[model samples]
Target: MKLLSTPTRRIVAISFFCMLAFQATYFVGVIGCATYTLGADAAGVSALVFLLNVVLVAGNLASGPLIDSAGPRRTLLAVCAATSVLGLAVWLAPVSYPGLVAAAMALGFSFGMSTTAIDAYPRYFSEDAGELARMNSLNQVATGASVVVGPALAGWVTTWAPVQCVFAILALAPLPAVALVWATREELTAARGEGAGCGAGAPGAGGEAPTQDAVPGLFVEGDATPAPDGRAGVRGFLSDAAEGVRLVFGRSELRVLFFIGFLGFFVYGAFDSLESLFYRDVLRVGADWMGWLSAASGVGVVVGSLLVLRIPKQRLSTRLLAAILALVGVGSMIYTGTPIVAVAAVGQVICGIGFGALAPVRTTLTQQRCEPGNVGRVSSVMRMGMNSAGTLPLLVSPALAAAFGPQAVLFGASTLAALIGLAFALRGDE
Candidate 1:
């Protein structure tokens, strides 16, 4: 009876965790195989990974409008189903690289597409900027938890069942999504109704309804009424997408945010890609411990996310971002010198803190700066920065590590962080 009490159903929250569970397994598998499957062809897998990013960019850009038009509920449901289906395809048909490429495209589009739209959910039900940050943090926690869970699941299934069995297990991903959607159907519709309630001509006058203030995330100004109904296959997408791009670039703040995302996470990539190998080979840790090591970094993210929830959004975002640059730089540099298993954990946690804490600032700032019509397009473009930043480091990191040994790599990461932090700190209130 207590469970049946009438409370706001967090269907979107449930959907996200479920989706993340599946994604974690897939991501771990893909990354795990990058070195092995690609083998001497490791160079090629790096390129393939970058190629997958292109699809990510396209999917990200398109998802904004899709969510804008059909709303998050329908849009996410379709994407989840598509991801599950493709996960099976990737499992069942382990074909040539070209087939894998096609599968990658589908997987990237379907699975990755949910990120932006899902991030926007707080506006549908909550208005407190801090609450929105918490929602975002919840996703982060879910991501970390799944990171812990998914790889373990993949490990168990791989030994007991065929690799294909992994796909079928993954197909279970969208199951919880179904329940989440059904439970929250009414609330989502109400949000769409509100958004659509605003006439098309009104630029910033989104659905006039106020968001729920009880939650701890950011306020959503534009989840306004549903996109105009009728004719849902690619026509409106082209027109709206073109407009969305035009509008986003027109704003100046968006440009700055784009740069921040690229520079900040670009530095992150430098460290993250090479850390595991450093831990395994140099620090002399084992495979079994990799999970704990990874988890060590994830703990930082959770702490950072929770911290973000407490901080005043804009008031603290810049300062924290600046501070983290120094923390990450110094922290990572420590790892190179000590290389002790215990010390490595400390450094990883600091790096993770920087990583987790920074995500909301970059993301929230981007959304805050978006024009009503351009939220979707702008969301995609910011992701483009993230994609670029994330991709370049993988290829560049190994080279950097090779050219100047492991110590150099850590110090270089430190330098990258220090420089970025100083830049922002020097910006002085803008």
Candidate 2:
């Protein structure tokens, strides 16, 4: 089919390869170290997560606007190239704390920047909601594949290779991304956008302007508006950011999403940060077993993302979200209470599914509720929910777990998570 010959196919393929390089090298080399071993103080893990959040927020907040200006392909390619370079730098860098922090920020910032950039790419490629969902789902699936592979490969580096060698390997993942960018150079050009993307300004559409539809996190300039610098004006950025903020307070959907993002981060942040530790310390499982658990969690993400498409949009309810999350909590509670890795794998899968369902649903709704002109800004604002909570809670949960106990902290955290889910379920979006 000509579709196979088209830019969409290439974009999806290259984008996925880029993710594989990123996820593996990233989780294995840095994130693994950043997370505290059960042998270490639990607070170490929390602090690592906190650092990740701070770096991600700082980088993404600034970069998100840039993506809005540069367009997705350019932004995505730039981030990938930067990451590949940074990974090498990490490999060669000194081992002191300052060096680590600097290198970590470079790696982290590149990864975070890439995420925001690539995420917005689909907006420039797809033509309708179905296409958008398909792209998102495909990207999610790619992400799942990376999650499964990243640790297993990296585990080898973490074990056999000098820990520093891990960065060398991490540096390689971006190679394909770079090559793909080059080979497909023309595809990412005006021709790649030959077909319509989401709306209004889609490149073709028989010379008619892009349809005036709203897409969160993808704010376009004024209709037929092209700035000389190719960036949104300061006024537009601030105004759009402001609109999303106002919506967060005034819109039922946005409010629910923000809270849900917080709860997810607060509860799941600590839990995920401790996954390796749970196996080693709590269950006495080995690295292979730990890797399997992580893989299983990846499956959860794929399954959940796939399931989101089938979900009836009209029936969306906070109560239902609560129930789903409550069940996820149950799975976690069972694992912790029983100290079973198998059981925890099940919980991870459920949580993954929940994440998939919640993320797309929340994003779609948030996009739908925002003003057509301010999609990108609003999306970024709404995103702050998960980002803030996900990163911040890492600081607290690990410390709390260390001070108290993993079992106690997990149990309490599970309760709080289920409570948030239930509150949303009962209260709905409002």
Candidate 3:
């Protein structure tokens, strides 16, 4: 049998290339702009990262409702257009620190929205636990493939051209996704149908959905009160957003999953602040090595995600997720704990496996626990937690790196992550 249907394959394709564009433009472009423009100043880079995360938080908050109200396809089309426009504008404008900062904010917000839409798309396709797991793993494979290719492409571009030029090329990256999504719009939207919204007691294999009494403001399908005016519309949106938050935090299973994701991304936030510095100062490597190492990690992600595909459906669990988290932490510790470039490359591969495996597992768990009507909002809530966790440490990472050195600070962070993972593993079922 074919592993995925024709429409499902198209969805996967749209997700892959759109994320590839995002990875190249925002992930690499922001850092490259900071490094080349700011002379690799730690403070400047941290500020840029911090700004991106802040805007990302806001975007995610807004996107959940947009996706739920407007539908994921439309929301994705709008963000893809926004990304393209922002990239072209940044490319045309004379390169300056201020210009880069503005571009970062716009791009960061778009990226945040795109992330929510992409992740929530799987639920729109299937409610079956095994199918959801398979789709999520494939989606992660797309992400891993993008990670492998996007940075390497950016690294190559920087060799012969200025880093600013990467944005110009990235301007066209989302155009294909726009065309593809628009073409497949009706079929994809139709798939959402009546089953998209789940009522109370309709949880997936992971655990029970929040009861009506437990989640006071949960958005029940067919129960929405019509708004009389524009002001009511605004209030309605806020109410929906608030309901999403309550749904996530109010459920016991979701709460544990939320904190697990928060801890994982907390480690990544520190990486955002100090990882490039670690490359330049600690390993004494050229900028290209950063791209190469990221690509290595991407390879590991592919391997780990593929591994997830081979596991029996009966074996998927929160305990397994905790073990994967611990593995990721150990890989990160190895990556940062040593001075040898080869050893670090190995560590990147190991760490990448953890990240790759982590997404499918976490997403499966969240989908299993979430109501269909609130999928977009619930996904956004989880993103908000992860992004908020990521944003918080940036405020102090520069100082911590300065006082303790980047290598030492990073190693400590990794160690803490491993211990948290182990602790969660010991706690048993969600």
RMSD of 3: 7.9
Which 10 successive residues of model 3 have the least lDDT summed?
212-221
Q: Please state every model's RMSD to the true fold in angstroms.
A: 7.5, 6.3, 7.9
Best model per lDDT: 3
TM-score, one value per model: 0.66, 0.75, 0.74
Residue 41, model 3: Cα distance from true site in angstroms: 2.9
Name the lDDT value of residue 262 in candidate 2: 67
* Residue lDDT tens for model 1, 1-430: 2342221335435544555545444434444333223331334444555667668678878998777667777777787667667767766776456655575566666655777667665566655567667666666566666655555565555454543445565566766665565555434455445433556423355434444331223223343445565565357777777676566566655555666667777766655455545644577754334445556666777787678778776475544556666666666666555758888778778877877777776777666666666677878777766767877877776676667765567667677767777777677434
| Per-residue lDDT of candidate 3, residues 1-430 (tens digit) | 1533355676677778877776776655777767754566667788888888788768887899898777778998999898888889987788778887898888878888988987776666555678777877677667767888887777677677777777865688788778766755543344333323343334442434434333232232333434679898999889989998899889878888888899888888889978888887889875667677888888998899888889887788888888888988999999999989999999999998998788789998889878788889999899888878888888889899889999998999999989999999999877
Off by over 4 Å in 1: 1-13, 37-42, 68-70, 92-103, 120-169, 186-261, 271-290, 308-320, 334-342, 360-387, 394-411, 419-430
Error of 2 at 402 (Å): 3.3
